[model samples]
Target: MSDVVPVKLRPEILAQRAYKQGQPAPANSFKLSSNELPFAPLDSVVAAATGATEFNRYPDAAATKLRQALAEHYGLTAEQVLVGAGSVSLLYQAVLAAAGAGDEVMYPWRSFEAYPGMVTVAGASSVQVPLDRDSRVDLDAMLDAITDRTRLIIVCSPNNPTGTYTRQDEFERFLERVPSDLLVIADEAYIEFVTDTEALNATRLLADYPNLVIARTLSKAYGLAGLRVGYLLGNPRVLNAFNTTAIPFLVSAQAQAAALAVMQEADSVRARVNEITMRRDEVRRALIDQGWPIPESQANFVWLPCGELAERVDEILRQGGIVARTFPGDGIRVSIGEEASTSPLLAACARALERYPYLRREEAEAE
Candidate 1:
């Protein structure tokens, strides 16, 4: 592909690749690529969505009812919350609202794959702070990377693809160091899976930092990914700015109703989240015992850092009927899916380690 453009599209947009989703599994394989809940949408949620039959009427641009539910759950007022099609959409809005051509939007690299795209779409330069050796966000490095051009800094807890997180104390210290005028977004899309009590919950710190915003989604825990409903908690004024940048009626009426319904199903959602977390820990431990250098994943996915052997391992996973997410030269992220996926996934990993012994911890140390 030449770096030539046939039309008057933005050069950045032309050079940039759109977000590529994980590969789908074959008929007989388990799809552990996307970090989606293996469970189906709750019957109550489905009924609520279906009940929103007035398709001809435009959805509430304000997303009032859903926002109210979220606000109530968070012990905040409706003015402090902003709902969007999904947390990713809200992230896009936040970037666009705060940044433009000359500004910089910072986030940990190897964090959310969507962060770079959102920054690009907002016409802002992306400053990606490299993750630490453990694949966790290095708050100190991020603070060091900050400069006058910085407008927004996004912190993804239980970071996507890696499942690492920033702790509360360090995060608060980092927040304190950040320029007060600069906007900060805490991306908590996988928060429900976090078992660590010390983990950063930016929503709790919202009252302390007017510039801070917390973005969360029902897509992960509530099985609302298909419905596309997520929201933000922050200063009413800041969220108001974000709302202005959002695509009108982005959160569909069905989505709103579904979100509202799911909010009431907290007990069931918690139970499912607990199941995934338990499975994640078990899988991670099993991989470790097999001499694989798997990290401690608090989220509902485990990252296999295969380094240069990523593609080869990906093919191996596919061969074993386990469709995990592969990031070429980086690593493979296997979502904690149905219990049925466990045996095949571990078998594939074991096979990969046997074929590429260098990825095994013992083998690496021997070298």
Candidate 2:
């Protein structure tokens, strides 16, 4: 509870904590806390953003050209695309549009930490289905949790923090079972990092399901995190409803230009993503070899299931000049950054594992 305010405010709002970004690392340490791209922005993208120097004017309220380009890339009409500051903004708009007091928003627990807060801000309840033993979203369990009050469902593929993805077949089955009138958001924020052929892309099934929408961002693969460009692809009507709840001209002109430029730099972006994904695999393999019991990661990060020793592990990594995102009592999320980060990251994990030998899967099971 907070101290008394001068004016009245929603009790729930008072109780709710604000979203916290990943911690900043010291100068000598690699900040692997946020799952950010390690590479610098492409020259073309930077030039385009700087070229939009009309500071006196507001951005295009509709973001028409960028939306059209994205539509063309995805084989859809411009109206089917709704661009926003970032995918997170679009998600909040969707929740506010579809849910309200007494309504429920559903998603996997231990998924994106932002899910519950979005629901709360919408005056809606959150129904968090627990992840399976492998830390993957359990689609069957999600289907079983739907209630009449449920207004929105979010499925995060290559789910945040854990780095595990939903299978395409399982997702299709889950979507088929979802009520046609209900809205389902496939949050593919980290889709570009996924190397697994069987991982759910969501866009492939967008044509078949009007109730389904895809939320994606250029932040990860295209390295546009600072510009905050993201979009939604789905039925035009559904996007229209979401747009109604959006703040006007929130996407700046520079951001729109950067988005357009980045779209055209797909080859370069893919190459960068390939390097990160390869590095991610190598890091995961090394950790597993060190008996850390790392989960199979399809995203640009790996999960270290440190359990109650998360704080200690985080400290050890910090001491080794590596800063990872640590969830107290849960685990750590080590992002795939520059190749130079690998040695220190591995060293930190090895030290943690040696100190906490029971953290290994085999050791834990035997205990």
Candidate 3:
């Protein structure tokens, strides 16, 4: 496996590295690195996946049944729904359908790491707007970055790593400022974990804004991370254009079945999501009380802005039997997991703060 290739490849792609996943944990450790649900697969979900015996045949290329179920759940027509292997895959398809070389795709930085690479694949450029001190999307700065070349903008509410959400009213105002013709994707992969009523749920705003498309996934809340299934909702005309770029039969039959079955257990999903939200708030509060300068997280994880000490802190957490997602010099995101993992996570952070007292200083003071 050397760098020597038999044929030419895209230089930009070769220059970029493949996506790096969160580190795996040891046998005895808690793996909170990926924002995966800690619970085991539900009985119904397991049965649904196992029942799909016809693996010899290709899956429905359009994912017709799964799309219909999702559409009905949201009170939208089936045409408004478009299923994919995962929201990540749908994101790639949408990007490909929108922009190409010389076009600009706008989204907040430190949001989804995959955005830059995906845009590059589409032969487009990324216009990253920096997040505010609280790690929330800086709407004003993003608005100012828009130009005639801007074709698409991705808005990640309860944004990744940081876990800060965009307020509904603020986002509405932000939308009003953007060009009507441009596409605005609201990536709400973790929307189920949001307890704040003020949080932006873009599906509600879809009818008013024909330019809007909402991306959601069952992988997080439905406890089907292995299924690799997600869906998009938008005006049928806009979504149809996106559909043209999709990879055929990307979602397996089992994934569709699991998604359909999980949709029936709404109460179960709500209870589980509620638990994570409570744990998320508890961890955020505990870190703040410990003088760790943690941001309020509205998602299923809490962010520790460790800056240069991110790797060291990550090692510390691992040693304490909790593996978290680390961003080198930036910070660490610890997903809310089983109740048992909570104490070890907090203890590790408490110890980390004691060792690096400078990290506990007020933001202004630390600078």
TM-scores of the candidates in the order shown = 0.97, 0.98, 0.98
Clashes of each: 0, 0, 0
Q: What is the C-alpha lDDT of each candidate?
A: 0.90, 0.92, 0.90
Preferred candidate (lDDT higher): 1 or 2: 2
By summed lDDT, the worst window of 10 consecutive residues in model 2 runs over 358-367
Instruction: List, residue by residue over 313-344, the lDDT tens digit for candidate 2.
Output: 89999999999899998899999999999998
Model 1 misplacement above 4 A: 1-5, 363-367
User: Could you tell me how far off, in angstroms, the CA of residue 102 lies in candidate 1 after the best superposition?
Assistant: 1.3
Ranking by TM-score: 2, 3, 1
Model 1: per-residue lDDT, tens digit, 199-254?
88787789999989999998998899888888999999999998899889888999
Clashing pairs in 1: none
Residues 1-367, candidate 3, lDDT per residue (tens digit)? 8868778988888877677777788899998989889888888988998999899999888889988888888999999999998899999999999999999999998898889999999999999999997789999999999999999999998899899999999999998998999999999999998888999989879989999999999989889888899899999999999999998989999998898889988888898898888888888888888888787778789889998999998888888999999988899999999999999999999999888888984752558
Higher-ranked by lDDT: 2 or 3: 2
Best candidate according to lDDT? 2
Best first by lDDT, ranked: 2, 1, 3
Candidate 1, position 153, lDDT: 94
